[model samples]
Target: MIPAGRTPATVERAAEIFGKSFNYFQNQRLWEKLFPATIKAFHRAGAQRIVRLWDEEQLLALAAQRELPFDQQDIPVLPVADPQHPKPAEYQDEDLLDVVEAWEALHEAGSKITQRAWNTYVSRADDARETSAPAPDLEINGSRFWYRKTLLDWDKTRMGRGESPNAGRKKGSKDTTGPRIRPTAIARLAAAEGLLRALPNLPQAEMVKAIATTQNVTDRQALRILHEARANLGLPAPSPTEKK
Candidate 1:
């Protein structure tokens, strides 16, 4: 029997499967096997790899058809059900094999979500869109900022050990090996507002350098944000830095 006092979100989540593609696959394949599992993977090393790997036109075409041949691996896909979930109450002895068979059929059809692709997707997980959204969330950016502040409260020598002073986990390796850093927007706007607290404020060239070295977010994404800020927020456009 389902838990009686589940959280509201948990109950809602149980009702809707996020599986848009793989759900379609299961009913079509008539999966039959002893035990079946579905998994997803991501690759995160480079942007060019992201662009080169996925053909948008092909994906759109595949979606419109709704009859995906399982062997097509280039498309991004996810399974409908959590593979590790407990079998339903009606799963009798003979019928259990059917689930395994389904896993085999789906496996053969070629919709495996590889580990590399999953890692890549996670690497591109931007926190900005999350913060600006309606729902309340523990803002990852805000968490990091607070963590940084707690480090400064400790002695200079204690802070250098690279531990999260408040949270007690080791600080990210970058926190130690790299130069002190701040947000790109903070750096860009600080000159105009005269708040350089705990960060470097450089000339135009170094402003660009600070963006490249400290922020490490993609320039294309930054440019998009710049335009949106200018139009929507009424902030002036930041001029491109002449390459030094």
Candidate 2:
């Protein structure tokens, strides 16, 4: 019998049946390519946690086809419980754009910012009051995503002011007279921000250790970077008595 509850193991089993890596489905964008309708319906239905059994059946049927580059139309349509009732208005926006898509959109709009820089901007959006960057519109399974139109609108507003689509100090703003941060330091802080977002529930001390191991820095240095990352992301710093 098919599993009654959708869990990580269920996803893994489905991935195996679909002949795709588990991570492929774990990433929302990649998974949407295969089940766009299901995703749309899920989002439309207020994104509740319940998983429909028909979705699993659709996966199995698609796998049976053994077709490479399957057409979305070939997938079974999601049946509505009440055909007489009209569905809620469709989401007017385009498919939710992940960080990668946002980065690409900025580049296409003549911004010269690197992907890392774009990521840093996104990481700091909630705290970086100096810039007008928009915070993520939604998060799915720990990954943050923004609406395509929201990003394009932000880009257009920036471009209209003759500013680069990338975030920076406003024109005629006072330059920082304090000691400049090293490029390596900035890179490490950004990397730490990414790790913190990925493993948000990890203990502070353990997170520092993980960063130290991955970044090849001393624990003290890693702790410092993690603290700075937390500040940038508007997350609270660990208590002084907290072990590091």
Candidate 3:
């Protein structure tokens, strides 16, 4: 129901702004980025009355509920140009819930993105690309996707060309392949492993040395990997040794 005393133009404008805000509210954790866009959208829709709905107190309260960062104490309120234009006391709670539910349902059918994980997946792709010719072939066995063979193909192709598996390209260009790390990619490898089989059975010194050689990393880098692996595996970290 439209608020009492609001003109038809005001109600229409509010509805338009509300429509654009569905996607932003779906990821409740991303309210910081979404809130400002919502305020701007309201302004663009000529719903200056609804702009008061985004004051600092309400924003901070919403942020607190989501455990998000919102440090602004004062948000500048836009002036209402027409004195006779009616402003609602507050937004209707029922209407807001309806839109939020619709957004959640929409996202549930699409990507289950609570936060943007593109960089994380891209990092995984780069690691797999290190040893494969083409990118890791996407294989779906039931619900699981495997890329082990694709990585092997990448490695073979690079060797055939006499180029290193992870060759560097010029900056600012698209890097569809993956990241090029020095010999010190052991830590990343260890991180990918699960706690159950992540660690090998060996003395601390020998284990570090073995990883260093196999991963083509420095002994120091290997030690760092061991530290991280142990932490991930719930094992006690080895004492740091002096560099002789």
Candidate 4:
């Protein structure tokens, strides 16, 4: 039931914004959230309210015995809303659980960047003449290294290069086999996934190096993203030496 002077629209808006919110498909956490939700509201910018019904006689009796401020008449029975465009109050970004998921995704991506920088690099396809070559296969003969890294501009390149290899779901998906990297390409790697350049572990370093080499840039963007992510996670920042 809405307040005496309030209109139906106001009640509808409240229900839309908060009723479903109260029923977010969470597990046992939903019950745990009530306390934190109340606290969050208290710390929030607005003077918020937390409304609930005390149907259990035991609790109601305790509250009544203690002369609680609550009144059953104050608990409004909110009506559900139409599903088109949700009301503004129903905006979930303000909710903490939403924040948790966003943080988790970012953190997971960042760690993957740290541990498998090359895989991260490979995930992003080449930009120019888009080349989707698999990580290069190196034949190391003493000092004379051998691999190929020349790239075809993706725009000029076509999928199903009769001899080229492919991965991922689409024909234009990632290159699991294409060109090998030459000695010169090493200097150019790190454009996309940043520098797994000289990473001690050869497989990852080599894969990312191939991607960066094909990408043809010196920007350490991926490494920077990972490093910053570490900082955000409360880990120490990785310096140039450490990243290298």
Q: Pick the candidate with the highest lDDT.
A: 2
Per-residue accuracy of model 2 over 1-244 as CA lDDT, tens digit each: 1111211224566667767787876565344465534322322232234332224555666667645555533555434332122233422244354566567656765776678766666767476543536777766556555765677676655442224434345456477575445555777889999988998878888888888998789999998899889999999876667653
Residue-level lDDT of model 3, residues 1-244, one tens digit each, is 1122222222223223434343444334233454543222211134223322232333433444434443453333333322223233332222221112222322433534222332233335445643322432221111111232322223234432214434444445487486555333544556323322644545677776776787677888777777777776677654456222
What is the TM-score ranking, best to worst? 2, 3, 1, 4
- The digit string of per-residue lDDT tens for model 4 on 1-244 reads 1111212222223223334342352323333432211111111122133222211222223323434343321232222131122343542322211112222323333422122432343346545122333332221111111111111121123343332333233345476586554333333322322433234333433444455456553346434443443444454544455445
Off by over 4 Å in 4: 1-69, 72-89, 92-176, 179-244
TM-score of each: 0.19, 0.34, 0.23, 0.17
* Per-model CA lDDT versus the true structure: 0.30, 0.59, 0.38, 0.30
Count residue pairs with overlapping backbones in model 4: 16
- Stretches of candidate 3 above 4 Å error? 1-170, 173-188, 191-201, 239-244
Q: Please name the candidate that would achieve the greatest TM-score relative to the true structure.
A: 2
TM-score of 3: 0.23
What is the C-alpha lDDT profile of model 1 across 1-244, one tens digit per residue?
A: 1111111111122112223344443444312221122221111133232211112233343344435444543443322132224244422222111112223322333535334432342345345321111112122211111121121222122222233222322556445665444354554444323322233233434444444444464555444433443454454444465323
In model 1, what is the error at residue 107, expressed in angstroms?
19
For candidate 3, the per-residue lDDT at 144 reads 16
Q: Is candidate 3 or candidate 4 better by TM-score?
A: 3
Q: Is candidate 2 or candidate 4 better by lDDT?
A: 2
Between candidates 1 and 2, name the one with more favorable TM-score.
Answer: 2
